[model samples]
Target chain A: MAEHTLVITPHKTPRSTNITKYFSLLLLTVLLIVVLFPLVVITLNSFKTEEEYFRNGPLSMPSTLSLDNVRAVWDRLDYTTKLKNSFMISLATALAGVTLSLLNAFALGIGRIKGRAFFLVFFVMAITLPHEMLAYPLYYMFKEVGLYDSRWSIVVIFAVLHSAFGTYLLASVFTAFPVELLEAAVIDGCNKLQLLVRIVIPINWPSLSVLFVFFFIWTWNEFFLPLIFLISNANQTVPLAVAMFQGQRGAAATFQSTAALLGTLPCLIFFIIFQRTLAKGIIAGSIK
Target chain B: MSYKRTRGYIGFLIPGVLAFLIIVIVPFAANIGISFTKWRGVGTPEWIGIDNYERAFDDTTFWASFQNNLQLVVAMTVIPTVLGLLLAVFLYDNITHHFGPRVASFFRAGFYIPQIMPMVVAAIVWRWIYQPDWGILNWMLNSVGLDQFSHNWLGQQDTALRAIMGMMIWFQLGYPLVIFMSALQRVDPQLYEAASIDGATWMQKVTRITVPLIRPEIYVVILTTAIHAMKTFAPVYSMTKGGPGKATVVASYFSYKNFFERPNVGYGATIATLLTGVIILLSVVFISVQTRQERLESQ
Candidate 1:
């Protein structure tokens, strides 16, 4: 069998082409294990008692499933508070950012504003400007304004950081839409604002909704700004809380892993559900 | 057809641009000024005329951090990208040849999950996996009779940055894989069939035909991933904290600590300015290369 026949283009062979097919299957399984291994490792540890975790090492399957670690971590990390903070900030930023960007897109992309090209270039350039570049100045300014700990500060910062992207996304959406329908609405006594609300939002809801979900996830996972702005445990988002935990006291394995697991679960579930759109936004960035 | 312009059009662009200006543009300008001043977070600045920049350039820690970032370019950008292309191509072959929708999407989703996983959570996961005694990696080595190989993966200086790089590769593979797969999905399959008719082998088809066609998408992946590698901070914040004595401290973390932790505001600002300039320069070069290639292709 090893000395066998010969090989040809994949089209000529049938599905029983054992070696290649098996190789492909094996390759995929390897990737699957690599990708999913972290989740499994954390989950397995989270279930085990600390002694069991130590005795069995990290490889052993949990002897018994338990939610004890998750429960303990929930209280320790103030999970609900951080989750609420994360949600509130993410929602506010998404709402404000998306709305502003939608308007900007409509103006420059559809309305043919005077500085359309300039705005487009400017916003696109923001994608390259790492947020770290302005981290300190914003830190000082927020401190001086005495607004650092307020939920509004995080919302405002995330919204502002992301609005340029929103503008760029929605600008493309606006530019590519059929102009006749928009013009028809304008001729039919709908004002610009009314036309945007009545026509564009409904027609482009699918495209626009992707922007919302993408923005929500981005703000939800945001770490650096919230780290600077929302200082207290009470005010910090989940990622910032986790970071402060690691920075201050990362030694506690049981608590930290549990907290990390619980915090990540929401985003994981959300992405699994909307993985297609997430991929689209990512691929959009790649091509752009 | 004539297009009518309305004042309301400008109305649409203002709110967003204003928010950006207030947040990003203003802070950016302020940082440039801040970089030149000899001030902490608060108080009157004594203009120090490039002293902070000079100090930053002289800082040994800054160079050490920069060394880690350069290492990341190979680990994070180059290796993962090469591996991702291979994964995409192989599965793409499976898709075009043997698999149906179920298999295709299953692999696609598996590849993408890591890309969307929050960085903090991912760092937590990997840190556990690299745990010294209790870590699965060391345990696996023991089971495989390679116990001599295992060490504290993210702890010591020699293996620490390298360990982080290994995980970084795993953490980053998804982006390029998904992007390339999407690119492959859009390719003209008839070209492959024609190549196959000409007796093109598997390697030939991939290298000679598929790669050249998907070159633009590949470049996009490289550029984006390169930027991500450069701007990384959360992973450092979570997994290592510049670690078991500064082995994994990349430039972003160096800037972050100087500003916030040490309160060296001016020096921190200088480091940040340098990083931003590098990012902008890289983006300009990448965009020009891409556009120039596009022009040549069009001709």
Candidate 2:
């Protein structure tokens, strides 16, 4: 049989197709609205003046869009400092996580070294076990070492913890790496370090970028560890600051929504920017 | 020599191993040791030998929290996995075919937006919406003449768990959807095409081809999301603080309360140890099941 003869386009009757199309579209649209509803409400309330929010309630149309709540929440929460702290922590975590993962993967994935299975299992546990199991002990250790309430502790913790996933991912990626390239480089007298710097790192840059992006956002969004460790206002990251602020009594509705909007905006912007990388990373990270 | 080259590569692992030991391994061991003791944060722990564990077993509050976590598994794991499979199939099979990939991806991105936000932010947004007097839910209820339905969602014991669970379903839906959609890409379009040529309805195609083909991704989604549900803390902490009389007290929050808030280090460590054991057990079981399935398929 000719292959072309076998390649027939599946036909659906137009009537059924039209009905299913409209039905699926309707279901998707309604679900999307429900999913986006909270975000939309928060964004709208953030723009509404306090007086209007109070007088008209949260659902009422804002008579005029205002930046007053945003400004108020920003200054009140010292959001700039929190954003800076979050950036520093996230950046450091991403850097440390990627470096550690790359090194580990190089040894395990390409080196085919001794105890690879043992190390792999160890990292898997690191990813699987809850941070709560590590929390009190870490809290005590950090306090004893004078690292408690310091941003460095969080950086160290997330870097190590989050790198489990990173190592797992990068190791698999590196395992499938072209052996011909390594052999060719070796024939050219490239040492391990030289091969890594010149061949491996440059070639695997996209995978490394995925790890970097995930570690950054995961660290940014971490709340429990930060809440436990970063006790001081000055050292707190963005999410911790906003969450801690929520615990305060008599917080106004408009201010609450404003804080939520501002707290959520940075990650939203990051997602929009790194979304393609994120989607790729999610599939890469989860499917294997 | 090649042996020397391999030895040098071993040097690459030193930093990662050292950091893992210091940061995770040591703390985890300490936490385990602490579980078998009696201490109040400051004093040296007295070796009480399973007393904390015994107490935890008897603790109604711990049991309540554990039960609540089971409910969350349904929210975070079961609901998301089911809904994600349907939505993934719909997007990949129907939307991509009918509306175009761009439209399908647009909806996918919308669903995923909440997953990218900080859990605290999502909790805060939901909390505000669930606020009693002036919140949107209440406002909408009153507007729709369903004033009787309005209540302080996060404040009432009856509504708080369900409210948080609802938020979690929304937060978790995108994870499986994205994973399954990508998994679907790996499926042979010809299978669907064959089924389509045979006049297999959409639901029939989903149940027959889409699901079995993406079984591996489905397992992954369930395992990871179940683990996520097991360790859920931030939403509970932020939204209700496991409040309205221990109604929403998840195991993580309970452990946290013992660890930090109430300062019961020993009992807290006990709770943490148990929680860790359960999570590890779940992962092991799921992984083994996946492996067995793969082996069977290969055979």
All candidates: TM-score: 0.93, 0.95
Off by over 4 Å in 2: A1-12, A247-251, B1-5, B196-199
Q: Evaluate residue A115 in candidate 2 and report its C-alpha lDDT on the 0 to 100 scale.
A: 90
- Cα misplacement distance, residue A24 of candidate 2 (Å): 2.7
lDDT of 2 by residue, B1-299 (tens): 23233556899999999999999989999999999988899978899998998898899999999999999999999999989999998899889989999998999999999999998888888888888977889999998899999999999989999999999998889999989888888888789899988999879999998887888888888998899999999999989989999899999999999988788899999999999999988888889998999999989
- Candidate 1 recovers a fraction of native contacts equal to 0.74
Docking class of 1: medium
Q: Residue-wise lDDT of candidate 2 within A1-288, one digit each (tens)?
A: 576545542334576779978998998899899899888889888888767877787767777878877887999889999999999999999999899999999999988788988999889878888999999999999999999999999999999998898888888888898877888888888988998899999999999998899899999999889999999999988998888775224447888998899889999999989999999989887854
- Which residue pairs collide, candidate 2? none
lDDT of 1: 0.80
Residues A80-125, model 1: lDDT tens digits: 9988988888988889878877888888778877867887899888
TM-score of decoy 2? 0.95
Q: List the residue pairs that clash in candidate 1.
A: none
